[model samples]
Target: MSPLFPDLALPVPPDRPALRFGDRSLTYADLAAAAGALAPRLRDAGRVAVWATPTLETAVGVVAALLAGVPAVPLNPKSGDSELGHIVRDSAPTLILTAPGTELPAALGDLARLDVEDVDAAPGRGAPYAVEDVPDTAPALVVYTSGTTGPPKGAVIPRRAVATTLDALADAWQWTGDDVLVHALPLFHVHGLILGILGPMRRGGSVRHLGRFATEGVARELNAGATMLFGVPTMYHRIAEALPTDPDLAKALAGARLLVSGSAALPVHDHERIAAATGRRVIERYGMTETLMNTSVRADGEPRAGTVGVPLPGVELRLVEDDGTPLTAYDGESVGEIQVRGPNLFTEYLNRPDATAAAFTADGWFRTGDMAVRDPDGYVRIVGRKATDLIKSGGYKIGAGEIENALLEHPAVKEAAVTGAPDPDLGERVVAWIVPADPGARPTPDELAAHVAARLAPHKRPRTVHYLGSLPRNDMGKIMKRALKTDD
Candidate 1:
């Protein structure tokens, strides 16, 4: 019923910057004009493809698509030809929008193209375009999943989902026009495009994109004027490692109002290291592409490490057993699958009714494959994905995330991932894949196993330890356990 972004229509100072990428910046008026100019061209299109590059044009393309009431499908720039082909064939966008100098791969060459830079130039200088009133059920974005099991499925997100999620986050994070957000995340996913770009715009705030993630760049922006910093664990790990020697980096972090980490769990060791150095706790939130945002550690609440805080306003969350029964009485030890129902939920998977039907329960709760435990105080700590992270070993249902965190506590371990392997005696055995801190002085497998036993229960300790130079990770810094080779 109401517009997603009300502030864009209101009269704000034309000089107030709405977005900044490296040296280039766009004011609210400039962004409005740029998006307005391109919206008219896309008004009749049903769906469009956006070449999601880490640039100012990507933001403009998405905004223009939203203004035009068209669903935008973000194409990952690094995706392979096969994956790109699958997306193009699936979504069937009318045209592909990209920057002027971008060289598209052959997978996208056949589609009609429109350079956002051209429309961004002098198209809307004559008259301001009126903001259109889009129906709440209209699809705003068609974001694809990570495709862990099969080919990626397009999740059709509606305008109401985007608006409600942003509004809930604003209430939880105390976000406003005064807060300037800074990040270098890719615009293809929900964490980057919806939250990083649209979140600030909804609040009438500003965003400063780093173009690429670097500790020096993050420090420069925060020290200059940016009040918030959003990053994944890898970026924060480098920052934690660098803060010991770089006083400027520590000073920059100390001046930041909020430092949020998502996409994966931030190891408690890194969390403590950063907090000890800068006196700021890095807040972690949990969500997925199918669901915009389910939970976040409130800015005004306790900044607890290793736990994603309570559910946000208007979201109903519950932990359920495998039999579809809800688990009541959270004793901080029982792990269950997280099921959620809220306005932030996506409408459906594009062209796949079967998958969409299987994702939700008969009562309408969307079943998230993530497993988590709830504390007595209502904090939700994600254990891991149900497919890989939940290991039933020695008659105990143990979470790999807790074991991984314990392994990271050891001084000899630099990076770690935990999984389960088949065993004749035990149904499954806990196995730890580790990257040693030193190549020459690698800790013995027995010693590392004993270290985990000392920290956690004996049953939770790793039965076997495998050493590697590095762990395979996706772009989001999450360990790819499926790619790991665990040998007997």
Candidate 2:
């Protein structure tokens, strides 16, 4: 009913820092004035595109669009020509917003460019906002999903969804205005943009972007009054590697109130190592492009190392089978596909009514396609994606996440990803693509299999092991499992 950022429009202290990126920082007053300057221009535009470059311009541009009651599309700077072209053409944005020095790719050449820096960002500079016009159901952003299967689809996120999810997380994480979030994630996706940037703003909290991910940057911000840390598995893995020799890094991490990891599973080994050094356990949360956030390990709840924990406030979650029937049990072993229904869901896949229609069930629950087992205590442990992570091996339904975690526990393995491959007798067999800890002294397949078998059941052990210098990962450090599948 009200503007997403009600506090931003109100008067604030001149010295209160709202955002910081590297050396550049903006006070809450600075952001409000700048966004208000561009709000009038965006109010009448069909939809504006933002070159999400982890800069002040990108943040101000998106916030301006939100204030203007216009939809903003965040284009990934790292997208290739084809991906960029597809998005630009699909979203059909009226204009593209970027920083002064940004050299946009050829794909964006056709769109009119609005250089945000050139605009006046002086304190108390812009006209008054008409906040009463924007409705709760209006689209706030059109975020494109990772086009793993085909051309990326735009998920039309409503203002209400963003407001609901953020408020829910505030309750779950005990997040407050006093907290300062430190992260180096790209602003293209939900994790980095909506939750990482807009999330803090919604709480009237401050955020410090690391320009790019570095363990030193994380340590520096955390040591300098940052209460919470948000990162992907890759960043945490690096922190885990650096913790033994870096006392300052460990001390800074230990002093932080919360450390959250998502976008992909953080291996149990990394969790243990970080916990061992910092005396802090990294909590995990689960979410998707379609659903802003489904579940999270609560701040006051048990911080289970491998599980993503229970559903957030106002979110209704369930585990269903391939038949689309909801599972009745929570045995913590029965693997079922996760389904959720709540206000925190996307309205549709832009211009794809059929695709959007298929994403939800008859009863309106969005099928997540992620397979997981729920503990009796209500925590959800994601095994893997239903399409790739679920392995039917020798009549057993196996979740690759557990097996991958087991493989990571091995001293010889540096990184591990598990996927299912065709087998004549077994239907489908568990296959592991491993990045060995020691390239010269690789662990034998037998040793790895034995190790996994001892921890899990024999059926869950990898039927085949493939070694590589590194696993293929996307921008968010999520392993490209489909890429691995295609490799075979």
Candidate 3:
């Protein structure tokens, strides 16, 4: 399959920057040539491991590997030596792609290494790659999940899945050549790599890539006139908080073609507040590492507050009860596990056939491990993570998201995380981890309990509320619910 970069690279405006990282900018011709030169090196090396932080280097590595027909694996740069060694031993990558001075194990000392600076060196005006005939089902990339529930498993995302996702997004979101995207999400995550990078780039739009999430830096990009913005919910919250005094920041953000929030659920109030402050409502979407992204709310329509709008053009979703019976979307607020059937879904876990088999239904749908409800209009409201987040008290099951959403409404609460705590009589009780809005004026546990009591059902209310200095998060800013659960 031909890479999406070749045709996009051609006829691009010569003077304009096609990729931006900090003060450095690469024109379309520069990036294409850079990718063209690195392709052969990657081919000679075989499977490549990319650990570059979210920067132009990561983007360059991805495009070059695809062009060279090399299956690329992207890792968190902060992964320790032991973890990195595990990946190295398991995948046995032909080359490691990362920053120049990053430390490597003795096993990889003699192995080939390609740094972003090396790739940025004079473009090797070598033979343009003879497009390798890779099958649509062949693995294109391997990305490990958050590894919260268990050991990290490599998810094999095929070329067809990537292409299908990009094609669907372009059609659903109406991505065009005229759009300019200011992207702040990490490149290693599916949301960042596929939706933030490939989705826009494949459609002929330019990307202003940030090395990391910097609210002020992103604000500058918006001020510089980016047409689109993509980030996680936490990033948006911080951005909103940073602009409390500068009203212009909100105005600049409102002018974007679209603003996307994903990777974690965003509160309805946060969505409304962001929209009211900035001119555009943030389009909340739903997806995971297994599937790139299959649902989204449109920029033009009413983005129903809590719902992640309908499934994309080529995707189909079904709700199934615990007993494997299909549930009607209109069964009076009945919620079930979301099983997805889509071209965008990943092939399987790299070497975990049993786990892969377990993740899918007896039919073809991939079990998302997430519970959601669909309104009559087909909008999906993700209740919570099925295994780690549901609170079981007495004989009833409660969604932690409901209590957290209610807790967030309090004036003294900045954020909230709810987990099930083991109880004597009930299987588990609701436990809330709260981040205060005011350091000194934070509410007491009794006060917070009263606050949630007012909004949630008697059984759904949190039995204990613990004030936390800060929530533990991954590189992508998603609260580590698995870690928080074990903390207590």
Write one digit per residue (lDDT tens) for candidate 1, span 1-488. Answer: 77666666766677888998988888888888888888899999889999999888999999989988999999999999999999999999999999998999998758999999754353454444576778988899999999989999999999999999999999999999899999999999999999999999999999999989999998899999999999999999999999999999999999999999998899999999999999999999989999999999999999999999999999999999989899997888999999999999999999999999999999999999999999999999999999999999888889999999999898988999999999888899999998999988888888888888899888998888888999999988889999987558
Off by over 4 Å in 1: 118-127
Flag regions of model 3 displaced more than 4 Å.
6-11, 99-110, 116-129, 485-488
> Any runs in candidate 2 off by more than 4 Å, and if so which?
118-128, 485-488
lDDT per residue (tens digit) for residues 1-488 in model 3 = 65665544355555555778777677666777777777767776667988757777788888888877788888776776666666666677887787667775564446578785655553744445555677778778888887777678888998888888888777767888778888777777788787777776677767888777777667778888788888888888887776667676776786677888888888766876777777677888888889888788866557776778888879998888888788875542676888999888999987889999999988899998888778787788888888976666897767777777888888899989998989998889889898998889888887877888888766777777787899988777778887674445
Of the candidates numbered 1 and 3, which has the greater lDDT value?
A: 1
What is the Å distance of residue 23 in model 1 from its true position? 0.7
| lDDT scores of the candidates, listed in order | 0.91, 0.91, 0.78
TM-score of 3: 0.93
Give the range of the ten consecutive residues with the poorest summed lDDT in model 1: 119-128
Q: Would you give me the overall lDDT of model 1?
A: 0.91
What TM-score quantifies how close candidate 2 is to the native fold? 0.98
Worst 10-residue stretch by lDDT in candidate 2? 118-127
